[model samples]
Target: MTKRTALVSGAGIAGVTLAYWLTRGGWQTTLVERAGDLRSSGNPVDVRGPALSVAERMGILPELRAVATHAKAIRVLDSTGRSVARIPMSSRNGDIEVLRGDLARVLWSAGRDDAELLLDDTITDLRQDPDGADVTFERAAPRRFDLVVGADGLHSTVRRIVFGPEREFSEYLGLYVATVQLGGAPAEPDEVVLLNVPGRLLALHPARGEAGAAFIFRHPEIPGLERGDAGRQKQVITASYQGIGWRVPELLDRLEAADDLYFDAVSRISLDSWSRGRVVLLGDAASCVSLLGDGSTLAMAGADRLAAALAETPADLGAALRRYESGHRRLTGPKHRHIHRAAGLLVPASRFGLAARNNIARYVLGR
Candidate 1:
């Protein structure tokens, strides 16, 4: 019997894991990523619930546990650098918290032996037919696959070409976020220090003597900010966070000096359905509640479920796709609904909201 074939766009968590499972199920998988190389820097993410089960089955759980973020607690502070609350994280942070890059690397290392990975390439166009989809790449030659999965994340090119324009499906959750590496470390390697003011949050998370700093704030979309221009985005961040106290001045100085910065709007992706014919969506491309939604774990679990469906119905591609969508939707919807509330908790839009949150924190996380 001839093996089936799949092309997974985006080499992030979802894409890599999907490729891993597909190959394990005796399918030929081709993974494409637009970036020149794997992304090696990102904030820590959790692996919990069904995602933990999937990791255990894949035999990568031990590796994940080894690299888990060792941050002891999430320390909250006022604008004046005074500690207001210290929240213990071990109980509710799920099975483990691993840096995003480390998780991706683990997925890649486990799956690379079984699949072909094409870096520095993207799917420029995709044409679906009764049999399969004809794919055209920006730099590579065209090819046909039995199925295509868009695990490309928030602004997925596959989703745009297959489903429709991104704006139609994505709704801004009233905030923006940026993360940059700091030149000088501010906190211990095992601590997450956060300072919150009305509508803004500045956090410094140190790992292995290096710190990754983040700026999240409530703001309307800037006209030219969506283009990923680091200069314009930095200016907006500096302007928005101006005069804010508690080590912000030092962070802003580092932000200006940093050359590589990751910036994007904290938004949600909602679609009526996640598949169209042989083309389907996974991870953030299908339903994203941003980072707060525990997207990394969901992506890993989605890949596991999709691969299971395909393995069960290897001969029936359409039926397998439908099965994957049906099972995955139940897991994503309820989690997505809580994003607005999560936004309020992380970056309150009003002074009243901030004060109310602080009081509750003090009551629960009393020092």
Candidate 2:
């Protein structure tokens, strides 16, 4: 019997996690990434729920837990730097949060031992047939695989090749965020300081005594802000938040000089289906929850399900793809809705709106 082969696009969290699982199930897997190596500078993200169980099954549970950031505080604040509330961190609560770069490194380190990873390459065209997919590459030679999976991110190249344009499914969440590593520390220790003004919020996530700040601001659909013009994007963000209270002016000054910037709208990807023929979508490529929700957790969960389904159906690749989509959609659909709903509840359009949210948070949740 010929060994089954699979191709996974993008080497980020989803692609690497799926590759690791497929190799364990006796499938020969190859991964292609646009980046020369793992881009390990992403911000900290969370991995929770059944996803943790999936990691434990791979025997990397203890390793991930050991490197957990141990984030002990989430502080909500006003424009004057007054504290609103602070949420505590504990393993007993069941959420494991770590830096996105760190978690991707962990997954890749484990998966690379079992899979063939082609760095600095990407799939340019995908033509699927009955038995296999003929994949065209940008640099390397074309290859065929029994199955292809898009574990890439929101701007997934694989998704465009297999599916149509992104605008058809992406729903803008009415906000934009900019994140980058900085040389500053938070005003307080272990504090997740979030300063909220009208239609905008800037947060500082305390990490190992230093801090990484994230800026989220509301807008009315500004186009062409993402044309690889980091300076222009910074200008637009700065102009939008001009004269706003809080430490935003200082934050903007710091952001302007920052070399590494990740900026995008807070949008979610919703698709009627995540699988077609032998081509399937996983993680942010399939379902993205932007900056407001537990998208990282969902991505890990989706990757686990996709890999498990493929492994369970070692012989029937098509059935495996279908099962993966159904299983994952079931797990993420509710949480997706909850997050979008909570977005409006969290990001206020006015001072009264912000106050209402705080009152609810203080009285209802009593945080």
Candidate 3:
């Protein structure tokens, strides 16, 4: 019997994990990433629950632990930078919080030798028939694969081509988030200091040796905010955070100087089905719970489940896809439903709600 071939788009958490598991399951895996290499910058992410098991199985748990952020607490601050409340970062279930780039690097190192990697390339078109899908790449030669997986995140090319345009499935949560690296160490290196005013929040998270600033604010979608236009995005951030107290002005200055800025809307993706014919979606492309939810954990767990389902029924691709979607939906559905609650806690819409959240964090959660 010929070994099945799989092509996975996006070399992030979901794509790498799926590639690792698929190769381990006797499938020939090809991983394609648009960037030249694994990205070295992103916000921190968590590895907990089922994802921990996946990491342990892959033997990358020790590396993840070594690079863990180990943030002592989340210190909430007033507009003037005075400490208002502190929520300890304690996890009873052995959750590990690591920088997103660190986790991706570790996963990539673990899977790079197992599969063929196509860097600096992307699929431009895909035509799927009963047996396989013909793929056209921007730089690589055309090829056919037994299956295609879109782990390409919120703005997935595969999902756009296979399912529909992103606007058809995306649900914007009335918020935008941007992260930029700071030049110096945080004042409170052991804690993630957060300052919020009504619908806006600025957080400084310390990791490794440096710190990164996060800007999250509630705003109606800015018309004509192209994803590739960093200058316009910075202008929007500047206008939104203009005259705000605290270290926002300094952070904006850093944002202006910083070459790497990650910005996007806090949006969710809703789809009636995760798979169509020989093509399937994973991670944020399938069901995005936004930054407020445990997206990294879900992505890893979903990838493992998907690889297992494919291995279980190699001959019946449809059944395997159904099994993967059915089982993984159990994990992602609740996250999608409760995202608003998480958003409310993270970025409150009103002063009253913000005050209540702080009180809850101080009096209830802080303890």
Per-model TM values vs. the true structure: 0.96, 0.94, 0.98
Candidate 3 collision pairs: none
| lDDT (10s digit) by residue, model 3, range 103-206 | 99999898788899999999999999998999999999999999999999989999999999999999889899989888677778899989988889998998
lDDT winner: 3
State how far residue 157 of model 1 sits from its true place (Å). Answer: 0.8
User: How far off is residue 122 in model 2, in Å?
Assistant: 1.2
The TM-score between candidate 2 and the true structure equals: 0.94
Writing each residue's lDDT as its tens digit, candidate 2 over 1-367 gives 7778999998887888888888887789999998998886657787788777767777777777777764676777877877777665555546677778878888887777789989899999999899889999999999999889998888888888888898887878788888877775656656667778888878787655556878788887776565559988888788877887777788888889899898887778888888888898888899887455367677777888887787787778778878888888887778677765666666787889999887766666537
Better of 1 and 3 by TM-score: 3
lDDT of each: 0.87, 0.79, 0.90
Candidate 2 pairs with clashing backbones: none
Which candidate would rank higher by lDDT, 1 or 2? Answer: 1
Off by over 4 Å in 2: 364-367
Mind giving the per-residue lDDT tens digits that candidate 1 earns over 167-202? 899888778888887855546677788889999998
